[model samples]
Target: MKRITSFILLLTLIIAMVFPAPFAFAAVTQSAPTTEVPTTEVVTTEVPTTEVPTTAAPTTEAATTEVATTEVPTTEANTTEAATTEAPMMTTAAPGTTNPDTVTILHTNDMHGRLDAEDGRVIGMAKLKTIKDNVQPTLMFDSGDAFQGLPLSNFSKGADMAKAMNAVGYDAMTVGNHEFDFGYAMAMQYKQLLNFPIISSNVYKDGKSVFAPSTIIEKNGKKFGVIGVTTPETATKTHPNNILGVTFLDPVASVTAEMKKLQGQVDAFIILSHLGIDSTTKLEWRGDNLMNNLASNKDFLNNAIIVLDGHSHSVIENGQLKNTALLAQTGTALANIGKVTFDLQGKNATNITASMIKEADTKDVTQDEAVKAIVETAKANFGKATSEVVFHNPVPLQGERSDVRTRETNLGNAIADAMEAYSETGFDTAGDFAVTNGGGIRASIDGNKDVTVGDIIKVLPFGNTITQIQVKGTDVVAMFEHALSAPTIEKDGQVGLDANGAFLHISKSIKVHYDLTKPAGERVYAIEVLNKQTNKFEPLQLDKTYKVVTNDFLAVGGDGYTMLGGPREEGPSLDTVVRNYFKAADMTAYQSTELQRILAGTASENVPGEVTTETPTTEAPTVEATTETPTTEAPTDEATTETPTTEAPTDEATMVEDTIETVTTEQPTSIQDTPAASVEVKHDNVIPFDQAVKQKDKSQHDAKAQTDKETAHQLPITGEAAGTGAAAIGLFGLGLYLIKRKSA
Candidate 1:
């Protein structure tokens, strides 16, 4: 039996070796099934041995299954972590397509009703249109003063200016001081004609908004907020009646309020300020000056990203203000255009660049046909009156000066002469002289040149009608005294006549000489009136009232001539007189004499001869022998050796002969005719009570004073306040940190 069992075990071992543990069990089952034995009986016999074998199978299967599960979980966990880290990065990297980083803003300031270019250095509406067409998605804005410089603007009462601007597609504009030239009603009418928005943050009427406080434009997904601030000084500089019911608020305060309101709403902020730059420091700061106060106000400086300045006619390169904000001015008369570019994101500005639109670069640019048509139509309606040259002048004339109303210019003299001539010819009474305020002349005429109608208009741009007035010589002297006494006319602490007296250009026949060293009121040394008929010079008689010719500006006492406005007798219009003079003097005979000849006079026996003469001789005989000579007897003693001698005439007979000769010699008269009438003018010198009050108020609110006050207040209390706050915060934070650290 033992031998048989061993042999059987050996066979089993061989089977196990050949089949492996898993197949050995499957083979046993197959073998059992073929024999028809119960599978349960076979499994029961092999259970303990099978369990041992399955233990190894379970270990291997468990290891393989654990590896597969671990791989899947690790891969899924890694994928989830990666997705969580990358999502925020993608969101951060993409700026929405609608972001406004590509917006451009184009602006102009102080166009001053210049529909056409002036001096060949300016850009007109046509050129402006070309620029607009070339720049896409551009918003055009005028800072202010778009009207009131030329005849075209004045005759149409700003209608033509508005139409021209509209034709060029202006997007927005602001009101300037000159807009009130014709009065607020006219300004309102002009506003009505504009197709674009008009913004004036400070100007108000009857507590109602005459114009919007600000304008918002959305272009290229970018929002631009623009606010306008007219200088408060307008109240004094412009006619008070025009702004009678209006009140001008502080520009800094107005802008600050507007900016706060616009925050989070616009991507960029712009301020159109008609406030001129300060003359003293050239820095933007708050001071008594209107422009200084506006510029220096912290609120405005901080809030505005760009300031398009006007009135002062300044140009800024690189667009920097306080090294923070961007600022620009295109000067006056369409000389240049201002351009600003901004990169914006939603309501925030990221980058900015600014440059001036130069006239040279755009000179040949095509003009807008629409604006051109409007200009042409206006011209056609006005006829030659708008374009004709009034007369020709040999010298240039200009009216601008630092402080004084008078300027030294040949043109000024010519204008005064023309006025005087006109008054004399047109008026019934003998006009003593024609006088004009130096400020009346706006430009210089090139001497001896054909003065086109355009040149005449430029020189007399105010379009003031001439008016005749009668004043005594005393009153004329008083006007001169007032001009000299005015504090504004002084320079360098010394008040005296200019070397050229260019500011006081006067006509012929009236002579004025003043002492340089004399006090303001006593400067007039002498005044002479010329008798045109007899060609005689005579001193002015203070007691006698004389008729004078002057423009309506002076007759109404414009430019601070109080004397003229006070009880001045009325006469004919200066325009009528001038027209009459031109009529009397054949237009064909109108010839411009040398400035020197007009200033001096023709040479005479008593005067030096022509400069071109080769030789000069004295015509008056030398007075060697004053006494009459006695007759000498020709050695009458003929018998004694008579000497021949001539007898001199007796004193009585010589006197009679001299008297007869003097009587026979008549004064030389020239063919040139003199006008009959004389006109005297006085300027308005009285400042209205309201204007004085406003000036006082402005002085009190000087930016320098406000800044000083702020500095003083801060110096005393800021340190203490900061110390207390810092101590309290420090204690609280210390307590919290101690508690947290202790807990940790």
Candidate 2:
């Protein structure tokens, strides 16, 4: 009887061991609330703005490679459906079958409408599709600046961009400043056209958000709260007319409010941000500033896994910003794709990682045919506009930022010559010589390279149209003075290259010599206009009225060229004029290929032949665009990565207890070492606005944004629990043997 009773007791103990002890259940009950986040709406409006379920209200906290080359079926009736139909990427996770804890994020930014598979260095949408399709359980996102740089996408008013993204199966995207380039209504129309979510937390109109503020996505059974935020620069960086009714609040304040709104519902936080990381931005609106402020505050990381950023077009290496490894910015033009994986469980995530895939590493990736078809169709509709060679360049023309902004280059000569050549053709206003801001030209025409409309578009991406305006000769001299007024520095030790956006380029028909030793606004000592009949240089008449061919941007006082205008007489687009000029010139470059036009008193390399200045001079051969010009390789702009400077927030908007889930971290003294060395990367296509409507003042961000910091009592890890149960079962077997032997 005693032995039987002992066996029964051992059986009861073994059964109890199969499950957690009652005290363990009590511990789980204590932590259950932390895991069961309430389901709440996040405010997605109708139409483009979806109305997400509103949360409980203010609180704190927060693919296997396969290039699907499947060709499209040729049934005309099924063509549109096949192209527009979007099958979600490998993202669905069965609760019982798969590891519901892990998910991947695939992202791109600053694509700037580089949708073509063959354009420039852009990997194109099709290749990106190949790269994206390889990973399973992934969500695709674009940080912004996706729709307005190239002609093909812009020609469709952003529809091509939407189509391509749709075919590629994007899950979500943040609004980039360039999204408003076509105008606000068109931007919203584009939003309505897309198959995924477009969100921005700070963009509000009439006291309501213009688009959705946040979206909740389910990946591998884990709920990810994706909060979208665009840079406040959008208020001024784009056409002011487009965002007239929209108001952008402080980013920190918005983030805090949203965190409070989503207190306990999400498993992780993702900031799909267009806020760039750059020093050019003031302290308040910077990513690095905000991250530095919150580096020690894990709660303020607000449970955020990563910040996929854009706008500065900078590449942040190692996915670290201000020692906070949760931030990343892939440089502009889809050069790299970013990835982040999360082994998320409640608020305790020990396995989270972020990385980027470079273009050079994409050789093994293959394209998705449907996406390829859409992109190729967009290009086909645009015609050989980007790929077909417009003209075969015999010699390289220098339109490099350093040369164009500082001194005369053969490429600048070609542009000015094109202006003059265009002026000579039939037009309402005529005469005199042509002058354009060196800033107008963006890139160089590589010698021996086949020039395409795409290349020209890249050189003059802005859609500024040309117009002839009249100004007095004295004013022209003053303009030239302003153009040459920037102080010269020794090229050897300068921290930054001297860049003058307003540096003027003159036609071959005009010559102006400058004295660098003179004061600003008084540099030009002589000016001469070409006499067509005599092909000779003559002194300019100070009182003479000279008609000039220049772009409308300058005529409207853009780039500070306000001194040269009258009634604007519009002509062909600047690009169209250049195209026309190219066709007629038969690839002819300017005869004044040297510094013959503007004799800057530099090294005795090109001494002025016509001007009798005390400056020693040698004349360069008057060579037109020839097949054998000297080779000059302009240094390319490296991928820039900047961690923006930010100031601490005035309010402790995101404060919580410093529990075990959080850790104290020492802040880095300087963030300079975080990103690549500083370099100026020009963002073109911005519409000029009145000076009063610049970027907003100041910023705010909290390091302790998440409200809940309750440290739950320790619970067994799954593996630990399994091991404990296994050990208990082994002991139970031993007890059964002992009891059976004793009873026998």
Candidate 3:
């Protein structure tokens, strides 16, 4: 009976071992009952792998019983095995870092027209090549003013500049104001030579496409979208005639529209602007004049991360605006190279920084052989085209700095004299006075050697053409007065007149004087027109018109000379005049000639300067008699006694007309608006220049407000783990359970 009972127990244990009770259980054990069994009741332990069925009794009760108990031990062993196996799965990485791709961006700006090193200073194409070779997968860009600076750039009308840029492998470039110097025809010629795109969003020609506004370039599996914008003032401030058929659009609006169109398609957005840096206002329009509008317009700067600025010739030394955008510029004339690097991940630019590398710093770096060869070839070609003697100055020619402008500097005198001589060769109606802008002189004439054509070119880098206009004696005084008054004056007490106004350097004998202390319009209190036959200064009659010699830039009213553009006789090209001047002077010892010689004969003769102790009570003079007839001959005779015309109207309609009127204005024609004109001369009844400057300042202030608002929503979710540890643990447990069941 005991054996039977044992056998039954053994069968039950066997069935339980075979079935495994569906879930993990402890072992069942049997022990002698009564003598303090050590609480060892029959403990049945079920193994998860297989259930033990009691009905499947072992042939021997003892054997079955032992097997059931052994199975209980095996169940405990399985649980230990599961725990050991699951531990390693807890030690693996979360995800996503096994393989990664890296993208690098290399950038540069403001390469001007420099094609080679100048006097040990690296200026041109070679410098850019060195940078590109050193940095792999580099992308090169120019902010603007890539052409129109040196003689080579000028003589070829920027064709050489374009060819050189193409040879150097520029990826893209923006149009600068200076591009208009040669007119749109030359611009198109340059465009044809370029291997890359000429990008400018604001300039439109012929009511159709002219140049590409933006271009997307891909390198190393990364897409970079570049947009370009020239200053809006280009249409009016630059060559109006060249841009006559084209329209200059607002930069902010253009960029905004472009960015919106390119939104998710590009990995990064970059703006190459000819609009100089605005350091004073940071995000405001301080330097390039576009900052005020750009800062206020949110849509324009939306996704743009960096701006490569030019035109102001400033340098940004490691600074950022609004903590997101960075601004950088290389000082003008290719003195420095600007470099910026972008670190990108997938489609986002994760980091950015910039530096200005001066030629001094890059001097030691090895020159790129390929770029050096291209420069040498260009130099040889430029040298072969012209052969002429150039004058030189031992001392650096000083620029006009004082408020009383002096047009006849050693440099200005030289250039003016050259132009006067050059023009007479072709046109019998040669000009009397030679005029040039103070800004055109780029370098000082130094050293004792004879100046070569290259030396002259270095000083007069902008290839401005000489032009002659016929103006009345009365109009000349009016133009001179306009240049001397108000905003034209420098902070210093000195008069800010250029040589044409301050000294009146003439090819033929002429005399003029001004009362220093007198208010602007009254400063030219005494003026004289000389009869070369008599060689004596005489009072200028209001009605008599005079033939004036100047550059084409001024004949077309360049540099706010609206009076010069009005009905006047046109003479020979200004370039011809300047070249003739140099030839006539036959200046063998270039350094010996001083600029003072030009003004030696025109010193003010009025003793102690005549001062009206009290304001003149005399009524305003009557309208001066002047005609718009174009003449080919110079009048040697002088006339007297003409009254001035009535004051011009100051209404907006008139002002707008004045803004766009033709370059010629005879007798200050009542300051009436002329819609047909292209330039508005503020000399008449327009708002003061100071007030205009103030209005520009206000626009910049509003732009900063928009930048702050757009970046407001991107607060970082920093420290929070992307996934949780509990979720990982649960996944591991499930995996382990599946493995165990499959193995069993």
Candidate 4:
């Protein structure tokens, strides 16, 4: 009997080893003991893989490649993919979709008080609010500089903007330099009006935060920590008196401290930065500097996710920093709005996508009733003076700051001409020249458009009064020297022209030939005064005192021009001065004498002498007219004239033309609620994190690399666990082979 049992066991062992499928099935029914392999567990594993069987092949290949290249475990990728697939299965999903874990952020920056539509493009605040309501889980945020641009907001010292923002339901906003335009008290007043939080980690007064340093917002059970930063340039950029006691801290230090404060408290860290993208390019301390500085302290700032930036009027849809944070900046004047979508699972972001919506494309969008009412009311309040037609422009006027500051522009000439003509009419005396700072002319009139009081207000939004002052020719030289003396900031990697508001835009009565290549005071190579008496051009007399026309802002030492003493006496509102001038003067096509008044040349070589008293000259129109007897003709709302030759003078004119594109502002009779037709993803700008680390500090990178290397070398699982997993896989494969043999 023992011999017969041994033979049977040997025969069974051979059968199990060679063609064991039948035996394996029989063995499973017999249930040997605890050592027997569980067929049910193997089947359960197969069922999970079969659910998304099609994705498995590609996923495995991708996983293998990632592991080989990164030398890191691919478990995170697998977990993220699984979570993304399950996103659609949420119970309390976002409206119209099943993505509860995902949230949308609707953002704008540098709206600059653009309450009304322009060129039928800008959607205005009303439409923005409408769009925000439709996008589920959306948080609306403004990065700052929403004050002090349009007449509707500027006239009220930004109160109107505050009202509109309140109506739009802005979650938060940062402080911008323009916020201090009316002064700190007014800014605080506006802040009080806003329903949303005004936060800035950097700005301080008496060592206390000017506003809330950061705020914690909860949405759908997720905690978000948002910190704000303002530009350090606010010190010199705004009116000196406006921010008297305020101190702007370094953005890097402020952000780092905020990170520490909010470290364990929030799921995400977002920065509302008025610091723009280009620093060296703009010659200002910008977002790039902030990011670079933050990247230096990688250990502390690893949690920062996004930065909503402003201040340079830039458009960056998906700008990334070396610290693995995203940045979005919409262009100024509410021209564009940024949208960021974050898919968070648990406490970490699984995915992030960003894009910008252009206001011009927002034709389909509707205006929210509440916000529409607020905007309409604000416009109506300012409409009496704003809506009346003042003059007409046959050709487009260029009043862009960069153009007017860097060289002579037609809009500058027109404004100066009005000031000079107004000084004569209001004061009964014509000055030798009229000067207005480029910063004062904020907007330009579109060609073939009716110039309205609203248009003039937008251009000269400051409401400065015309001032007639008398200063020595030597002082004139000093003022001009000071005007151009403000050193040029960085522009496109080169120092071109200073962004100083003091850059002067002179009247047609004086011809200034300057060499920007030369140092500040030495830039003025020649100055000629158009003698009203001789009707001829003559060299400026340094010792002789001449009557000068300017705005009260400049006369009172505004923008570092103390040389031009306070206005002799207030003459008329600057907008009114220009309005009255155009009303009386002929509505002829005004062709800008390109490079005639302010000629840019080299100090080594004087501009080709064009001033010649040798030939008889035509009398310049008398700017001196008694205030009682207005000299201007009847003003027409819809005035048109024949187009004149618009060609520039010479090669020099070509250079200016190529450098500065003409800027024109077109106003529609009514504001339109333009909505974006579609959105286009501007490709991602991924900062090479490792390369950035290396560039920042070799020692830091080396230290980080050594740690990473050590971590990577360590096994993700214990040897026993890995061996058990391998043994299970081997047994499963062997079972499959035996089953196939038995079937054959």
Highest-lDDT candidate? 4
RMSD of each: 40.7, 24.6, 33.9, 24.7
lDDT of 4 by residue, 1-744 (tens): 544554555555555445523222221123556743211100011111111111001121121121121121122212111221011111122243356678688888878777765545466888887777776544668888886676776656677789888877777888887776665566777667887778776665543456766777776666777788887655544544455555565465566666666767777767898877542223224676555554455443444477788876666656554544667777677767788887766556645677877766788787788877877887777775467676667777776555655555677777787788766656746677899887677766787888777787667765556778889887887777777675544444544554445678887677665657777775665567767675566667777888998876566455556566533856645766777666665434245343446655554443233444432222223343433212221111101121011000000000011111111111112211111101111111211212232246667778899987676445254434445445545665655566555557
TM-scores for all predictions = 0.54, 0.58, 0.58, 0.64
- How does residue 738 of candidate 3 score in lDDT? 54
What range of 10 consecutive residues in model 4 has the weakest lDDT sum? Answer: 646-655
Q: In model 3, where is the ten-residue run with the lowest total lDDT? A: 649-658
Q: What TM-score does model 1 achieve against the real structure?
A: 0.54
Q: Return whichever of 1 and 3 wins on lDDT.
A: 1
Which has the greatest TM-score?
A: 4
- Candidate 4 clashes between residue pairs 3 or more apart in a chain or in different chains: 283-490, 361-675, 361-676, 362-674, 362-675, 362-676, 363-675, 584-632, 584-633
Global lDDT scores for all candidate models: 0.48, 0.56, 0.46, 0.58
Clashes of each: 51, 27, 87, 9
